[model samples]
Target chain A: MKVMVAGGAGFIGSHLIDALLAQGDDVVCVDNFFIGTRENIAHLHGNPHFKFYEQDLTDLDRMLKIFQAEQVEYVFHLAANSDIQASAQNPMIEYKNTYSTTFILLECMRLCGVKKLFFASTSAVYGEQMGVEVSEDAVALKPISYYGGAKLGSEGIISSFAYMNDMSVLVFRFPNVIGPRLTHGVIFDFVKRLKADPTHLRILGDGTQSKPYIYVMDLVDAIMRFKDVEKGITLYNVGVETQTSVTRIAEIVCEKMGLPEIPFEYTGGRGGWKGDVPVFAYNLDKIHAAGWRASMTSDEAVAKTVEMVL
Target chain B: MKVMVAGGAGFIGSHLIDALLAQGDDVVCVDNFFIGTRENIAHLHGNPHFKFYEQDLTDLDRMLKIFQAEQVEYVFHLAANSDIQASAQNPMIEYKNTYSTTFILLECMRLCGVKKLFFASTSAVYGEQMGVEVSEDAVALKPISYYGGAKLGSEGIISSFAYMNDMSVLVFRFPNVIGPRLTHGVIFDFVKRLKADPTHLRILGDGTQSKPYIYVMDLVDAIMRFKDVEKGITLYNVGVETQTSVTRIAEIVCEKMGLPEIPFEYTGGRGGWKGDVPVFAYNLDKIHAAGWRASMTSDEAVAKTVEMVL
Candidate 1:
C-alpha cells in the first residue's frame, strides 16, 4: 500500500518510514522540519519506494495536490510541536503545529477521498491524572499544557471527520517514547547537559517525577500491529506498563557516559517546568486484550536510549 | 462590573446582554453580524451602559484593542456558527467561527488580564449517545458533526487557558435553545415552513427525533446563576431534563399559528440532517446538585417559543 507520513523526517516518523519500506510499502514522506530534521531521513536518500516532500501540512492546497498526485491510501499524522515548555510561552505554536495541522490534514483527506488514518495523539491529553491509570475511555480529559490541549482538540476533529466522511481512524495516545534517533526528551536533555558540563548537572525539578517510557520500535510495532483494523474510530493508549524516574534516568545517563560521580543539582518542584504533569500512567488493558504489548520496560527503554545516544 | 459579550447581536446573546444590563453591569457587545442582526440590539441605542462593536472575534489585533479599551472584567463568549447543517456542508465555517474564535478570545483575555469567562458549548459534543443522558464528565467525547467537533475543540482550548493562566472558566453545554428572538431551529423552521405554505409543512427527519429544548430566558437564567462560580474549570449541562419530539413541536407550532389542521410532511430519516444525532439527553445531575435548575420544561419552552414567534 502507498502511505503518507506527515512528520516522516522526525524521530518516530523516520523509524516508521524505515519499517514501512522494509515491508515493501511505498512511503510518501512530508515534513517542514520545524521539529523534524532532515538528518533523521538522510539514510533513505534514493530508495525507490520512498518519496520525500519538504512541505507544511497546514497548507491545504499543496497537501491536496500531493494526495492527488501520490494517490496515498493511508496517513500517519505525527507532525506536531512536541516542545511543551516552548508552547507554554506562546500557545500559538501548539495551535498551529498540533491543532490546525490536524484540521488541515483531515480536510485534505476529505477533499482527496482518503479514508484511512493513524493519528499520533499524546497521553498529555489526560492532564494531571497523577495516580490514576488513565484508559482510552477515561471520563474526563483535561489537558494542562497547550500541546496537550491541541492534541485533544485534534482528536475531537478527527472523530468528527471519521463520522462525517466514513473514515477509519486509529488514534494512539502515547507516553514518553525513547529509543535511537530520539530528538528531544528527558534522556536526550540529560545527555546534552552532561556533555556541556561534566562535573555538575542541573535538574529542572525534584528528581521524583516518574512516567512510562516505551522504545520507539515498540511504539512502531504497536502501530503496525493494529493498523489494519478498519474501525470507524478506535483509540488505544500505547506505552509500557512500567515507569522510570528522572533520577533513575540521570543515573543511567551518568553511568553510560562514564561520569557516575557527577553531582545532581535539583530544582525543587512538583513539575520540571510550567505545564508539566510530574507523573501519570496508562491503562493498557484494551491494547493488551488486542494481543500487542511492548517488549521493553520503561527503565530498560531509558537505559538503552542512554547507551545509544551517548 | 464591565463585561464583553461576543456575538451579542445574535439570538441567545442579545437576551444575555439584556439580562446583564438589567443587573446593572456595563456591557460591551461585539458581533460581525454574520448570523446576528442589527434589530436584536436596536433598542439599546440610547443606553449609556451598553456599547457595541461591529467586530469579528477572530481578528486578534482588533479584539486585543477592544479588550484593552473596554477593560472588560468578564467575558460571555457566545460567538459561534450554531447552524449544524451549514457546518456539515462546509466544516471550515465551524473551524473559523467556533474553534478559531474561541482561541483568539482566550488569547485576548490572557493578554488583557481578564480572567472570568462563560462559554456557550453544545450537547452535540457528546455525539450520538442514543438514550444515554450525557453529563459534563462523560467518559468519551466523540462529536459527530463539524459544529460539535469545533465546539469540543474550543472547550479543550478553554480548559488549557484556564489551567495555564489561572483563569476561571464556565462552560455550559446547551441543548436546543428556543425563544422569541430565535433565528433558527425546528420550531423556527416549522413556523417559517407553515407560513410559506399553510397547507403543507415539510418537517425534516421522521419527526420522532426528540431532544430537550431550553427556552432562551431559562438558559440565560442558568448562566447568571452560575457565572460567579470562580472555579478553575466548571462545566454544566444547561437544559431542561424533559424532551419534546419534532412531530410534537410541529403540532405546537401549527396550533400556535391557528392552523392546527395543517398537513405535516415528514422527510423520513434517523436525523433531520447528515450530522444530526437523532436522539440524546443531557444528564443535569451535576447542575441540579449545585442548587440550580431550569424553571421551564422542554415541552413548555417549545410551546412558549411557538406562541411568541407566531
Candidate 2:
C-alpha cells in the first residue's frame, strides 16, 4: 500500500509514518513545515520505503503533482494550523491553512483517483458538550474557535465527496493528543514553562477545566485500524475513556519532572483561552466496539507526555 | 453614511440597498452577477446615491481599490454562492465564493479602516437541530452542507476580527428568508416548478421537512435595527417565529397561483439533496428582546413569496 501522510513531520503524523513504514507500506510524507519540523521525520530519511516532499497543501497544483507521481492510495490528512487559541486571533490564517488546504487536498485526491482517506478531526468539533460523556453521534458539532470550524468544514466537505464520488472517509475526532516531537500542546507548554522557571508554572484560566487525553501513538494506531473500514463516512472518537482535569495534568508534569510541588498560578478564570473547550469527555464505545481501545488513561497519557517533553 | 452592499444586485441585497438609499445613505453595490441579475438592481443604476461595481470579492486588490475610492463607511456582506444544495455538489466553488471572499473582504476592511459590518449568515449553520427551537447561544454549530460550513467559516473570521481588532460586527443567522425580489427559496422553487408543470410538482424529499421562514423586508428591518448595537460581536436569529412544513408551503404555492392541487412527487426520500438539513427552527427570543421581530408568519411569508414570484 502506498500511503501519503500530510503533515507527516508533526507529532502524531510522524508517529503514524513510523508505524506505516513498519507495516511494510510505502509512505510519502508531505509537510509545509509551518508547524511541522524536519527533526520529527529526520530518522526516516534513508529508509527504502519512505519518501518525503516539502509542499504546502494549500497549493492545489503542487499537491496534484505529488498525488499523481506517488500513486497514493490512502491519505492521512493531519496538516493544519492546529492552534485553537491562535485561530481566535488570526482566523484567516487558520481557515486558509486548515480548511482551504483540506479542501485542496480532497480535490487533488479526487482528481488523482485516491479513494480512501483518514482524516484527523478533533473533539473541539463538539464544542462544549452538555453531558459528561460525548458521543460522535450525539454531540451537535458547534465549534467556538476557528480551528474547530475548519475541522468541521473539512469533515462536511469530505462527507459530501464520499457520498458523491464513492470515496471512503474515516474521520477520527481526537482528543488532546500528547507525546514526543510535539511543537504545541498543553503538556509541552507546561514543560517549557517549568523549564524556564522552576518556581511557579503559569496556568491559563482556572485549573479545574477538564478534558480527555490520548497518547499520540494510541491515536495513530486507532486511525490506522479504522482506515479501511467498509463505511462511506465513518466517524470515531479516538481518545481514552476517562477525563482528566488541567490541575491533574499540571501536577503530573511536576511529578514527572522530579521537581518540588511547583506552585501553580492561575492567570484568571474560565478555559485556557478564548474558544477553548473547557470540559468534555468522549464515549469511546463506538471505537471500542470495533475492537480498538486506548491502552493508557488520560492521566497516564499526560504523565508519559510530560516525561517525554521534560 | 456610505454603505457597501456586496452582492447588492441579488435577492435580499437589492432590498437592503433600497432600504439604505431610502435612509439617505450612499450605496456602493458590488456584485459579480453570478446569480445576481442586473434586472434586480436596474432601477438604482442612475440614482446619484447608488453606484454599481462588478467585481469578484476574491480579488483582494480590486476590492481594496473600490473601498479606497468609494470611501465606504459600513459594509453589508451579502455576496456568496447562496444555494445550499448546489454547494453540496460543488463545494470548492462555494468555499471560494463564500469563505475565501469573506477573508479578502475582512482584510480589505481592516486595511481601509472600516469598522462596522453586518454579515448575512444562515440558519443552516445550526445543521440538524436537537429540538424545535435553536438559539444563538446553543452550541453545536454543525452545518451539514458546504454552504453552511462556508457561512460558519465566515462567522469564525468575523468573530475573530471583532475580538482582535476594533470592529463592530452584527451576524444575522437568517432562516429561510423569502419574499418579493427573492431569487431562490422553497417558495420560489415551488412556484417556478408549478409554472412549468402545474399538474405535477417535484418536491425534494418527503415534503414534511419544516423550517422557519422570514420575509425579506422583516429580515432587512431586523438587520437595520440591530446595526448600531454596541457589542463587539453580536449574533441574532432573524426569522419568522412560526414553523412551516414544505408540504404546507407547496399547498400555499398552489393556492396563490390559482392552480389545481398538484400531485407532489418526492424524488426518492430526502428533504433536500445530500447535506441538507431536514428540519430546523430558530429561537427568536433574543432578537425579539432587541426591539425587533418578524411581522409575517412562516405560512404568510411563504404565500406572499409565491404571489411575488408568480
Highest-scoring model, TM-score: 1
Clashing pairs for predicted structure model 2, backbone only = A142-B140, A142-B141, B205-B270
Residue runs of model 1 more than 4 Å from their true location after superposition: none
> Which candidate tops DockQ?
1
Error of 2 at B66 (Å): 5.7
Tens digits of per-residue lDDT for model 1 on B1-310?
9999999999999999999999999999999998999999999999999999999999999999999898999999999998888888889898889999899999998888889999999999999986677888887999999999999888888888899998988889988888878888777778788788889799888998999999889889889889986758988888888999999998888888889787888889888987899898889999899988888899998888888887
> What is model 2's DockQ versus the real complex?
0.22
Tell me the docking grade of candidate 1.
medium
Question: Could you give candidate 2's per-residue lDDT for residues A134-212 as a string of tens digits?
Answer: 7777534556666776777677667656655677888898878887787777888888888898899999888988888
Assess the local accuracy of residue A189 in candidate 1 as a C-alpha lDDT between 0 and 100.
90
DockQ, each predicted model = 0.80, 0.22
What is candidate 2's lDDT per residue for B1-310, written digit by digit as tens?
9999998998889999999999999999999998889899988877999999999989988998999999998999998988877766567777788888787888788778899899999887777766657878665455667677678767765755554457888889987778787777677788778878788888888987888888889988887778875747778888877889888888887887886666888876746667777778778898889778778898888777777777
